[model samples]
Target: MNITLLEAELRRDEGTKYSPYIDSTGNQTIGVGRNMKANPIPKDWTFPLTDAQVNQLLAEDIQTACASLDRFLPWATAR
Candidate 1:
C-alpha cells in the first residue's frame, strides 16, 4: 500500500486535531482520528499536540491497523 497516499487521504478525510474532541460517534479523539477510547492518550502528552506528534499518532495508528490485517487477514495483504 502507498502509505503516503493513504496518509494524505486520511488527513483530508479525518482532518487534523491538536486537541481532543468528541467525534461524530462521540468518541474522544485526538491527533488524526486517534481514538482515545481504544488507545488512551499518553500521559506525557499535553492538550495541544504538535504536528509532529499528530503525524506520529497517524503513523502508529496505520501501523496498528496494518498489523491487525496481517494477523487476521493475511490473504488481504499478500500483495
Candidate 2:
C-alpha cells in the first residue's frame, strides 16, 4: 500500500479541524481527528495553533500512523 495514498484517504475520511473538540469517546482531538489521548501534546504545548502549526501536526500524525501500519503490516510495504 502506498503511504501517500493511505494518508490522502485518511485526510479525506477524517477531515481537518483547526480547533480542538471532544471525540465520540470523550477524548480531546485536534487536527485530522487525532486523538489527544493517543497522541498527547507536550506539557508545554498551547492551544489554538496557527494553520501552519496544525498542518505540521497533521503531517507528524500521519507519519506516526504510517509507522504503526508498517509495524503491524510489514507486507503492505513490500514491493
Candidate 3:
C-alpha cells in the first residue's frame, strides 16, 4: 500500500486539528483522527500540538495499525 497516499487521504478526510477536541464518537481526539483516549502519547498533551508533533503522531498511529493488521492477518501484506 502507498503510505503517502494513505496519509494524504487521512489528512483530507480526518482534517488536522492542533488542539484536542471531542470526536463524534466522544473520544478525545486530535491531529488527524488520533484517539487520545486509546493512545495518549506526547505526555501532558493538554496544549495545542504543533504540525510536527501531529505528523509524528499520525505516523506512529499508522505504524501501529499496520502492525496490528500484520499480526492479525499475516497474509494481507504478503503480496
**Which candidate tops TM-score?**
1
**How close to the true structure is residue 54 of candidate 3, measured as C-alpha lDDT?**
90
Best by lDDT: 1
| Local distance difference test, each candidate | 0.92, 0.77, 0.90
Model 3: lDDT equals 0.90
- Is 1 or 2 the stronger prediction by lDDT? 1
Model 1 segments more than 4 A misplaced:
none
Q: Candidate 1 residues 1-79, lDDT tens each? A: 9999999999999999999999999999998888999988789999799988898899999999999999999997898
Output the lDDT of residue 21, model 1: 96
> Deviation in angstroms for 50 in model 2?
1.4
lDDT of 3 by residue, 1-79 (tens): 8999999999999999999899999999999999988988667665688788999999999999899989999888886
What ranges in model 3 sit over 4 Å off?
44-46
Relative to the true structure, candidate 1 reaches a TM of 0.95
TM-scores for all candidates: the values are: 0.95, 0.72, 0.91
TM-score of candidate 3 versus the correct structure, residues matched by position? 0.91
Q: Give one digit per residue, the lDDT tens place, for model 2 in 1-79.
A: 5657866787799877777899778988887788888887566667776677767777888787668868998786666
